[model samples]
Target: MSISRFAALALLALPLAACQPNVPQESMTDPQDATEADIARWYIGTIPDDPFDIPQVDTNLLPEEMVRQTVKYNGSEQAGTIVVDIDSRHLYLVQNNGTAVRYGIGVGKQGFSWKGAARVGRKGVWPNWSPTSTMVRIKPDLPRHVKGGLDNPLGARALYLYNGNVDTLFRIHGTNEPWSIGQAVSSGCIRMLNQDVLDLYQRVEVGAPVIVKRTGKRVVANAE
Candidate 1:
C-alpha cells in the first residue's frame, strides 16, 4: 500500500487505541507505516561480539516520527555529514542519494540549547561520562563519574564534538532514557536511543562534519 494510504489507516485506528495504557495519543501524526517487523529489525536486543546487551524499546510509547527511518533530504550537505535540527529534535545522517537516515533525538532543555558547526573529533564505545562543572553546579548531587555500561547516561556509544583541536564539551551519544527521545530534556547534548547510537557509531567516523541549527537555518562547518 502507498504511504499515504497506510498513514490514513493508522489515523483511523488511533482513536480505538488512544485510551490504552502507555499509548501516546499523538502517535498517529506523521505515521510512516512502521510495522512490528521494522521495529524488531531496527531495535534488536543483541549485538554480535558485543559484551553489553540492550533492552528492546517499546516504540508504542514514542511518537511515530521519533522512530528511526529513511526520509527525503532537502539539505545540501554531502553524504556522511550529520545535521542536527534542535527545534525539530531530529538528527539526519546524509546518504549518498537524496535521502538521509533520520533519528529522533532529545535536545537540550531551555537555556541549555546550543547551535553551531563542529567535527566529530573522537568516538567512544560505551563511553564513560563525567558531568561538566556546570552540570555539577546545577545538580550538586550528580555523580562526577559514571563507568561505561548499560546504566551509564551516555549509553552505547558517543561521538564527541570539537572545533579544531578544542573540545566543545558536547556530544551526540546514546541515552539510558529511551522515552526521552524527541523531547527537549538534555544538558545541551544530543541524545539518541542506545540501539540507534550503536547503528550510528558503526556508520560515522571520527572527524565527520556536524552541523547543528535551530529556526530552520543551516550552520556550515569550518574547514578542518
Candidate 2:
C-alpha cells in the first residue's frame, strides 16, 4: 500500500513477534519518528555537516544500469538480519515475512566489496570524516579529518558495523551526494540517501545483526 500504511502494519506486526529469538528492540522514547539529526548524533555525537566542505565528487559515480535489482531480505525482518544486497545495490531491513523496508544503496568499488556479518556497534548523525591512510595516499588533496556538515560525505546517519565485540570500521551511512545511491565509490562502506539513512537509523539500534554480501544473502522465510 502506501508508505505510512506499510509503516503502521510493520509497527503492528513487531509486538506480536516478541517471543521469537533475534535482536531485541530498544524501547523508543525520544520522538518516535526517526529524525535526521537523531540518527546523525547517535553515530558521531553531533548534528550533520556543512555542504561547502565536501571534496570533489568521485569520478566512479554509479550509472543506474549498474545497480542490480534482486537483493532481498531472506530472514526475520525483526531488529536482526539487516542485509545489504551489493549485487542489487539495495539495503533491506527485514522485519518479518515477505516484507522488508528496502532502500537503494551505494557500495564499494571493484576490489572494495566486503562480505560478512556485523552489528550496528555504534551510530552517529552528521558524522565527521577522516581519510584513511589509503584514501589520503590515493587522493593527495583529501583532508585528514573533516568537520561534519552538508558537504561531509558521512551524510545524515551512520550505522557502525561490528562483529562480535570487534569494530569492522565499515558503516551503512548517509551521503549528501544523493546521486551516488547506486554507485561504487567509497573504500568498502555502504551508502544510502540522507532520508533513507535517517529512516534506517531510527529503525535500527545497537546490537542488531548486519549482513553485508557482495553477491547476496540467503533468507529463511519466517525465521523470526
Candidate 3:
C-alpha cells in the first residue's frame, strides 16, 4: 500500500488497458445513428479501382437496425457460436460476456428460407461465385461462373456451411447488393454487408457452430 508501490502497479496496468478490443464507441450509444460506413471497415487493404471497384453502402437506404452494435444476448449459446434470427434479419455472434455482436442481415426469399444447425465447413476471401445448377435452372440468365471481385455476388468473404461432412451450400457471406440487407431476397445463403462480413470472417473459425432460425425457436448452445 506504499505510494510508490501503488504508482508502479498503475503503470503496469496501462499496457493491458491499451490491448483491449477497439470496439466503436458511437454505435453502442445509439444504434439508430449507425451506418454501414460507420461500422468496421474492410480489414484487408482496398482492392485497386477496376471496372468492379467496391461500391459504398448507402446508409440512407438501410434500416436503422441493419447497422452493427454490441447488445445483451439472452440466448444460451456460448461465445463463438453464430445465431441467425431470420425473423428479425439479424445475426448475432455470441461473445464471452453474455453479449453478442449483432449485425443486420438479409435472409432467403419466401420458399428459399429454412432453419437448421450447421457448422462452418470452410472459409474464403473474395470468393469466386458460381450459380448452382438449381439457381441456373431457376434463372436461366444467371451466369455459370463469376470471378471473385467487388461485383461478385459474394462480396468480401464467405463462410460455407456444412452438416457433418455434407455441404449444405448455405453461406454467411458479404453481398454486392447491400441494399438487399434486412430483406428476404437471397436464394438461401445469409447475406451481410461487405465490411460487416469482413469483420465476421476474422472472428469465426472453421468448424464453429451456426444456427439458422427462421421460426421462433428458442436459441441455445450447440449440443455436444
| Candidate 2 C-alpha lDDT tens digits along 100-193 | 7777777887787898888889998678888777777887987677766555668657898988889887888876544456657667899876
Per-residue error for 197 in candidate 2, Å, reads: 0.2
- On a 0 to 100 scale, what is the lDDT of residue 197 in model 2? 76
Q: What is the lDDT of residue 90 in candidate 2?
A: 72
Candidate 1 Cα errors over 4 Å, as ranges: 1-22, 25-49, 216-224
What would the per-residue lDDT of candidate 1 be over residues 126-148, giving only the tens digit for each residue?
78999999999988988778788
> What lDDT does model 3 reach?
0.71
Which wins on TM-score, candidate 2 or candidate 3?
3
- Where model 3 places Cα greater than 4 Å from the true spot, the runs are 1-61, 216-224
Alpha-carbon local distance difference test for all models: 0.74, 0.60, 0.71
Instruction: Itemize residue pairs with steric clashes in candidate 1.
Output: none
